[model samples]
Target: MPEGPETHALADRLATLLVDERLTHVRFIDPGLQRRRALLERQRVLAVEARGKALLTAVAGGWTLYAHSHLFGFWRFVDDQDALPDGAPPRLVLATVRGVAALYAAPSISLWRTDELGAQPYLAKLGPDVLDPAVDARALLAHMRTPRFARRTLAVLLLDQGFAAGMGNYLRSEVLFQAKLSPHRALEDLATNERRRLANALLDVPRRAYRAKHDDALPPGKDYLARTRAQFGFEVFERKGDPCPRGDGRIVEDRLAGRRLYWCPGCQQ
Candidate 1:
């Protein structure tokens, strides 16, 4: 399944191709959405935004199209409708004069009144979007302090969408590794400084991923530690037995919350 950063990047690209451009055509394999296809055709795209792992496309009309590329869904971009990739029928398609965006295998597709989007179950349940520039460490720390999350192990809580909306398997492992907090550590057990460190890492790691995906070069005058850039290649994830960056021990892999994670017992403990 696509994580938050990947989905946000997809939104950025789709916005580049579709925003402000009128939809020359629209198609929906979903019978419910197909009836609403007329809502999109010939209407200008107001925006394409990512809410967690889902894409919400707003058109000139009152309609907002929502689609989540759950586990198997993926997107393809083509120069025009004639250039659309051949395969299984697309669950959704939004075509513009510049390009055509087709969503495939992504089963969740629906239309909604733009104002009522807050009622959508998935959007309503999401925690703060980590990639949103407005989200800061202090805010995340507050979320960490909530009892519903505070009582849980970082290993499991990190995977909970209500804890952090954009989080996924690879990101959970990387955030804990970057914070140098053992996955087994419970949120309430951390020292003051340790909690601060974890909060910063949660915001930093995912934003770095968004940057690496959009552009490797940092913005002018901003400086990031060398290791941060290095981690885009991955410090611990999928690198079992590799020497830890701290040079104290080898990285090890284990299952937590039924997903594989890698960490350095020497540094993380």
Candidate 2:
């Protein structure tokens, strides 16, 4: 699954390809969406944004396209309609004067009225998107104090979208390690300073990952995401059994909240 940073990067790329550009053509594999194709055709994209793990593309004529590429869904871009990939059929396609963008295998693709977008089930449940520039540490700390979140273990709470939107597996381990707090620690048991540390890490780590993907210095190779992941360089994630970067302990791996987590128990005690 693409995490928050990856989702944001995708939104940015989609913005570059679609924003402010009128859709010369539009198609949807789903029949309901296909019937409403007139809502998108010839409509200019107002914006492309990432809300947690979802992508929202607002189009002209009071409609917003919502898509989430859970695990298998991916996107392909082509400069010409003739060059569009031929394999698996796309769930949605948007073409403009500049190029064509197709979303493949994504299950959650729908159109919502711009005015009623807030009532959309998924968007309504999301917490503050950490990657959102406006979400500061103080805001996160305040959200942390919510009654429900304060009692949950950090291991589970960090994965809660309602706790901190845009948080996922790699970030779960990275944030806990960066804060030097055990994942098993309950938020209610955290000291003031410790809570502040966790708040900082929650905001910092994902933004760092988002920044890593935007680096222009790296050459655009065949596998750009793999290259950026190397650049992001987690301190503890996926380094199980290897010596911790802090040198106090070896990284350990475990499954918590049904997701694999990597952390340095030595430094993260």
In model 2, pairs of residues that clash are none
Model 1 quality (TM-score): 0.93
- Please state every model's RMSD to the true fold in angstroms: 3.0, 4.4
TM-score of each: 0.93, 0.93
What is candidate 2's lDDT per residue for 46-81, written digit by digit as tens? Answer: 999999999999998999999988889998999977
Q: Which candidate should be chosen as best, given lDDT against the real structure?
A: 2
Candidate 2 residue 49 Cα shift, in angstroms, is: 0.2
- Candidate 1 per-residue lDDT over residues 117-166, each given as its tens digit: 99999999888888766677888888877787877999998888888889
Per-candidate clashes come to 1, 0
